[model samples]
Target chain A: MSDGARERILAKVRAALADVPRGEEPEDVVVTRGYVRAHTGGELIGLLVDRLTDYRAVVHRVPAAEVAEAVAQALKRRGVRRIVVPPDLPTRWTAASSVVAVADEALAVAELDGVDGVVTGCALAVAETGTIVLDAGVAQGRRAISLVPDYHLCVVRADQVVGDVPDAVALLDPGRPLTWISGPSATSDIELDRVEGVHGPRTLEVVIAE
Target chain B: MSGTFVGMPAFPEAASAATQNAQLRHNLRKATHTIRGKRAAVVSELDDWAELRAAGKAIKDRTLRHLDVYLEQLEEAVTAAGGHVHWAADAAEANAIVTRLVRATGETEVVKVKSMATQEIELNEALAEAGITAYETDLAELIVQLGEDRPSHILVPAIHRNRAEIREIFNRTMAEWGVPAPANLSDEPRALAEAARVHLRDKFLNAKVAVSGANFAVAETGTLVVLESEGNGRMCLTLPETLISVVGIEKLVPTWQDLEVFMQLLPRSSTGERMNPYTSTWTGSTPGDGPGDFHLVLLDNGRTDVLADEVGRQSLRCIRCSACLNICPVYERAGGHAYGSVYPGPIGAILTPQLRGTSSELDASLPYASSLCGACYEVCPVAIDIPEVLVHLRGKVVEGKGTTVERVAMGAAGWVLGDEKRLGLAQRAAGKARGLVPKRHLPGPGAAWTDTRDIPDIPEESFRDWWAGRGRGQQR
Candidate 1:
């Protein structure tokens, strides 16, 4: 059955293109890819911080040595009791926080949903669009861990921030499951009015570690 | 709507009522203008928008040109990634394949993302007949489903409904659908979204089967990309155990590099955002992350027929962004229901006739729905020359099977105007009968035209007669 439908569709397509010249190929089409890759000149980290804040995501900027303190303060402000983290995340980042850190491995979805928030590192962040790329890499757990909870607190190092979408795409591996998140979940469906916090995390806190 | 689009009235007949609806007109005007302003602001931020638009058009064109080759490549990649691929020639086959797939999993209920491809096939209605329920998870689609209404716009299906109307729908219908609304829910967008979140949480957690449509399918990598603002799509894509995606054959891009161009073009042209909140990409059945069983159904309902026509083939490049709908003057006044298809607005005018053929009154009248304005062309990300295709389809309608009263009248006019003496005699006859003509209304075949327009009074003397008497004296 599959072969029959497949052959018929391909045959119809072949018959439709009978008028084209034999020598013409898909590569013959000249598509100029001259669009700018990165718009920010040199203030990518600053732009990333600014754009994320514009999305109503809480932004924390601090030196590398103060990363733990920043996470602790963000968790304290939200009054989160328990947080989920990927196993590979640096132990020191959550060492200062008072909340219990639960590893994502073998945790049921219902258990993850019970947690107040999830904190982990990102694959990279785009400055112009204010998006974090998660490939289920070392510190980033499966897509569900970051999605199910009510709050998400992500950490982005200064070196992992890119200036634009193309640069971010170049750095990530597509073979792995990838999720690009710009801000907390939002919906503009109601008469085209944007309302944040639908199904995913309602509150997003980003810490830019220099 | 007569429940569905079948046997619907012509465009002018349907639009007459919609134009008189001041509330709908006001709602559409406000919503479209807001989005239009936002789209323009974000689009101008990119310095090379024109180049990006050009690349988007070129990539789609090249992909369509070599579709057979790329489709085979896509099928191989998807199968190699442990996802099953199915081929469907038309809507019926596609629906049957999906229904059977759902039954194979022994599940009666499935959660759905807002997919136009499934809506085109009326899959939910089909599943209803088979004793299965399909829950619409998108906030807009949920409004449409609960209200029992047709989707008027592509992006926001409930564009015609205001906050008050949505609040009433939720209060009246939410309890019947599994979760009830909060007591005395306020008419605010945030409160309504939260109500939906509470109502759909259990369904998402318990759903074993999920179905969707994709924005772009990377042929080389077998990855399907779905970009959405709300996280409902992520829930439907990730939480379920079995994922079935029904996509049109034209959604393929040759490579991930080709996908980069569309990733930039789509979000800005669509929600007028720098980037949407959520973008999910999965190659196939990921062992532990997303759904373990993935099925990709490629649909080809009348697409090959569209591709055969050289002039009509460009309509296939549409990315369903609804930018044309937001920018259209006719759409703002007449609204989207008049088009009578899953696709609507200016793209609908050209695309519906090509996909469904100009057989029904609604389909035949779509090409003439537009004012031949080029605003849709200017904003189209894929650069579909919509006005050009509309004119081309108009010609096809006139030359095809059925004959209309207007065609006969045009034929008579052509015959008389072919010769100078016949034209002069006809003009003189009309001149003599000028007083008998009605100024406001015509009696017979011209009533449809004159119902909404005025008829010009005929002059006492023909222009030929006035010129003929003066020319001989000047020659002497």
Candidate 2:
């Protein structure tokens, strides 16, 4: 649109576009983008918490100093004895918990699935739509660590929460493989009825540290 | 509109049979209505919906207007990244490339996400012919695949089948595919979903190759985006060693910022959710995350022909949300199978004919299938003026075909009105034969026309005769 069709397809595309004036830049096409980026008002953290809860994610809020204890309590509440983390993850976070914390050093598909859960810091979160964006940052490992595990415990700082999708998209890097997770895996294939829990994580728990 | 399905029955005939199925109609009504309500609720949450729809439409228009430039840019960007880029002018070329890519890896099976492009190219069938088994991992695609059935709806392929039928399909066919359904499996959505998860988990974990379609491709960064509700997309995308994606040329956006508009619009319009559970975006091959070797096939497959037409080009703006299907009255009654294409509903009616041309009986019937109610246009997120396109395509369908009775009637009327003597003579003849004319139905050729409408009564006395007889008063 390849091989012989590469030039052929491009010629066809150029020919088909005879109606447009030649050399018109894409920016000159006059897109009416009057839509506001953010639709929500008031506090962002509270809104993020509300939206996440609406999506059926277990959300907890605490002061920044209490983040480790909160992480420990989340694992204890789930009765999780083994948790996975990236090497760059803060030691204090897992030091507070009694579970055996394994580092993500190119964990195989089976190894990641066998763990009780995975806890990683997110790149950002959207308040308007309860979403956590992962960018394989220092704390967040490969995309598999968050995906294969049945449970995901993501840590989002208060400053990382954005008001809308555009706000979050603006701050993201296009070069990296980014994953935006709103809640646990779900489906509406059976008669258009939504049922939570599928191949991805069945349970999603988020901790917002202010 | 793939070449594999050119000989389907005309729309009226297929729709007539489909509408007669009471169970199919009930299922369609319930499912379409449920999603329709959900979509409306989510869409109304934002006050700037009209603005967003306009921006989405403008972006697609701008991209399509200079689609050549974007394609070249996207190719360069993707090539600069670690991904291998392949261009296919037709479905056969696409199938050959993907089959060869899989063969190079020495893999016999591949896991797949729910992709409209792959279905349009009939990739699964092509893979099967090459001794490869492609398992559909999406729950809806799974239902359609397990039942040995064709998908009816775009988003939910199994919308026509209820939970009871789904359980039957799973119970009967699961063992043959790979895993067997549990004996205690019930007719609940959750239970059925669990069965699909267990069955496809084996495929996802073990698959060495995976094939997918992109919702959008960023030309600036060489990124490919996939938005899905289930984690199956992540599994096929990340877990595979060799990944191949087939994307239509129209799915490109100029920059990464364009995703913000679609991310907001697509989820609300498709599943009626504030946000779909998962969205995965990757540029080429990530070092240790996704597939080591990534192949991106940019497919035309008759899209350029669609681009050639002025009025028909607007149909390319579709995002495959199936919002039009959920809201369409014709789709509610006739179902998607009647369209005889992977794309169904209002979008299909216009898009199918343009992509495949109106030469076939089924494609010709699509334009006339609409009631021209304009509901599809109002609900469309990209704002494709569907009724206008339907009417426009109807003109194209009738342009060179000169055998219809309406054409003959119009020709006779023109001949009669061309001269004063002919008009006077015809009026006198009609006045004399007025008593013979039936009040409602015209005799031989017009019987079917009067079934729903009445023919106007003929005037007892010709106006010419009355004017001549009235003398001075009438003349003055």
Candidate 3:
């Protein structure tokens, strides 16, 4: 089935594009990409905060050494008692949160779902778009940890924040599974009105450690 | 696959009847207007919007022009990454392939991310016939599935249903599906979403097989990207042991770098967000990560026919953002159901006809659904000239109908317009006899045009006569 269908479709496609002049390469059509790579250019951190807040995520900026304190405060403020901590996330970051730190060692789907939240260090953050990209890296863990939990707290280092989508795409390796979170899960499916807090994380708290 | 929309009435018939439903019209107007404002705001945020639009269009055009080459590259890359690639020439074949894959996994039930491709093929119906059930996980999709209704919008399939309607649907239908709605569910948007989340969570957690549709497939790395607002996409893409993604062959991009353009373009154009809540991108299978067994099904299902049309093929550049739908006046009045396909609105008017051909009355009437307002093109992220394609498809439809009165009328108009002298003579004659022309209706075959409304008041005086009176060749 694969062999026959594949050739037939390809032949049809080649036949369909018969209008192209002979020897014309794909690039001959010359795609002019004059779009700017970055849109806003204020203090990147401040812009990131503005964007994250627009999406209704709680954002707190703290000094580099006080990330754990911020994490603890965010959890305490939200009254989350237990959080999924992926491997390689600096223990010091969540050790003092006073919340139960459940290890994400291949946690079951239902188990992860039952946890209070999952907090991980993001691979990168985009300032222009306010997106946190998780590549299932050592610190980020797999895609499930960030998704299944009802609440997600992400730690963003100032160094990990990029300017825009293209900047993040340039730095990312597509082979690894990637999850880009712009806000808490939201939907505008009803009457085209946006309502935050859907299936993903109802509450997304971000700790920006400068 | 084609059974769902087997005998839909022509667009005019359906649209007129649809407009009579004040509730449907209200739902559509509110929803479309809301999205239209948001889209304009986000799209205007960048000074380089036109450039981005051009680049997005160009990328898709190039990929489509050499689709065979890129598809081969994608297959090789996916194969190298431990994923199996399957080619489906049509809907039946794709459904068969997916059913077989699910059967091999021995899973009676599968969770599905909302996919136009799947809906286009009616995959759920096909799977049901084969004794396998596919559960739609997207919130809007869930509402439609439960209501036993067709999707009315691309981004918000249940946009035609208000919160009150959704509450009723859930309360009445949720128990039979899997989990029941909370004993008491309110009509608030938040409550409805929560109900859906709770109801679908069980299915997401325990599903052994998942079916999905890709937003973009990178031929460069074999990475398939799914952009979604809810975690359902992430759940289906990550939790399942066996994952199958059915993608249209036209959904290809030549390289990973191309994703940067589309990623920026799609989110803003769709949902008016800087980025969607969750965008999951993966290349085949990772040892201990996501799905252990990955299968990519490339489907044609009339896409090749669409590609063969030079003028009509621009519809293929659509990323399914539904920006055109949100900005269309025709869509706002008649709603998505009138278009008679998984695709609706201006893009649907052009794309559906080419894909399905103009053999059916519904297909033929689709090309004429729009007023040729060009609003869809202005909002289109990929800059598909939907109006251009609509007129082109209209010509195809007219040509297909051998010696129809409308075709004869258009032919007469064309003949008159071809020679300036004849056109001027006809215009002068019409202007001299303007009082004889009825404002209400024309006699005989022309009555069809005025069945619903009166004809224009003969344009006071011909523009040609006005131009001549103003000294045609001289600068006024």
Candidate 4:
């Protein structure tokens, strides 16, 4: 059944593209080089830190060997007692944590809102903009886990980091569910005064696992 | 669509009434602010958000460029999947097609999801005129229908009303539709939601015909996507015996790959969520799982005109995220009703004029409704340069009018500037006439410009005369 539906939809797509000028695909849009030279992972991390802080997200870094310890320490520092763990989370990342662990499961809105914090791995990170991408497939669990929690600790692998917006788009799959995060949720009032965390997490913590 | 706003007053008159309502302004401000904050917070979580936004924009632009092909492919796919497709050139055609479809189904009542396209064509009113009753099953839409009101916001159609006003509307109007409001109804959010649920439950289960609009139609598989915060869309798409969708041609995406990008952008941009609660997708129909008979109405209704313009074509990239509306300063002040159309805010200001043409005073005035602050441009997910389009349309309106007074004024100013002697003489004459000039304005047409501004006073000496007195060598 799914195959038939997919085939039918594809036929329509082919017809639609037939009339579109066979120009270069958008991926071919030329990108001009910036004056600043591309940096090593360490320098990129620093740039991410500066941009994230500028956007009001708290950023932290730890050696890969101490990932579990770092996660425990950050949760303890924030006074979080219960942590929501994505279904496909790496067991070693949370082995040293003492907080009560709740498996990320699909729950009603009210039930999900009861969790204190959520910890998950991001699909990719943009060093230039300090953004994180979540595919909500494995490491990220359901989309609601990162959303309903008051605090979110997103673990980013240095290798997963990209330099710019276009580069990141090339890596993302359009069919799967994807979530993009820049900082903690925020808004500005009529007086132009900024407020944080209206619906999503009030606090965002980036755990850059080296 | 044939149901376009034909005789509406100029935007200034409509906006004047909207701006005067302090209570309405307060409600709109509070609601929009809350949603805006929520959206921003959720959006910031993804470091790759800008990339996703750009990707979404690229996909939409590409699809629109080849919309004719994609639409044809979609029609073929739908037909292959056992659905019928109809082409609607305008609202009248769309309404007539839908009425005939319903008549063929032999059903007098149809359940509808909250579809902006349907509202744009005034499908319900048209259906009523044809002796068919189309029920709006979405909770917010039901409230609006019960009260006989227009939708003020894209996502939250009833954002203009408070809970108390909703309670009153439900109590007074629900009975006439089908179900009666509870005997003792309260203004609490939960209570209101429960009342709407109970009222719509019977209609959803009983209706044989269902009508809807697609969020994104994947040309790859002839699949139509509908995302909603409420699950009503799910019921309408599945439970009905016959499902009919009236979708704008621009809603098509070339493939499922393109659909993925919008799925990411739309939910986050619209309701400020990583994912919406209900995402209902269907292609034609299945034997027993969903509606067995399906009809797809591909609507042109001014979209082709919108596609012809180079600079304005980007307006078609809109995902209907409502982010532009949330961020617009002008929309915050004057409210949606001031736009006098189904679409309201920055998108509405540009899209409506193009769709309906700037023939009416209301359509012409919409281009000038903004302060041109560019907030809408900044927040738009698809990157529509709303301010650029507004100025472009303003030029069109001015050129279209060909007013003798304006032409004469420009011609006279050009003559004076073209001749050095006449320019110098006019400048010196203006200096001498300064005392006679009014401090604020010149009255009549100029009064509007000076109403909220001050005109500068002329100096005692013109630059040329001052330079002449200093002598050629002393000019430095």
True contacts kept of each: 0.67, 0.86, 0.86, 0.01
Question: Candidate 3's C-alpha lDDT?
Answer: 0.89
Standalone chain B TM-score for every prediction: 0.92, 0.92, 0.92, 0.94
Question: Poorest 10 consecutive residues of model 4 chain B by lDDT?
Answer: B1-10
What would the TM-score be for candidate 2 when compared with the true structure? Answer: 0.95
- The interface RMSD values of the models, given in order, are 1.2, 1.4, 1.0, 10.1
Off by over 4 Å in 2: B1-6, B415-435, B439-441, B451-476
Candidate 2's residue-wise lDDT over B1-476, tens digit each?
11345477999999999999999999999999999999999999999999999999999999999899999999999988899999899899999999999999999989998899999889999998999998999998888887888889999988999999999999999999989998989998999989998988878878899999999999989999999988999999999999999999999999999999999999999999989999999998988888999999999999999999999899999999999999999999999999988889999999989988888899999998788888889989999999989999999999988567889998999999998899989988888898898888767778878977987767867778788878867653
Give each model's whole-structure lDDT: 0.90, 0.91, 0.89, 0.75
Which residue pairs in candidate 1 have backbone atoms (N, alpha carbon, C) closer than 3 angstroms, thus clashing?
A: none
Model-by-model DockQ, in order: 0.72, 0.76, 0.81, 0.05
Just chain B of model 2: what TM-score? 0.92
1 against 4, candidate with superior DockQ: 1
**Runs of candidate 4 exceeding 4 Å displacement:** A1-210, B1-6, B419-422, B462-476
Clash pairs, model 2 backbone: A2-B87
C-alpha displacement of B451 in model 2, angstroms?
4.4
lDDT of 4 by residue, B371-408 (tens): 89998987787788999999988888888576687788
lDDT string for model 2 (A1-210, tens) is: 246978888999999999999778888898878999899877999989988998889999999899999999999999998888987998877778999899988988888878999999999999989999999987998988898888899989999999999998899999999999998999999999999999999999999999
Ranking of models by lDDT: 2, 1, 3, 4
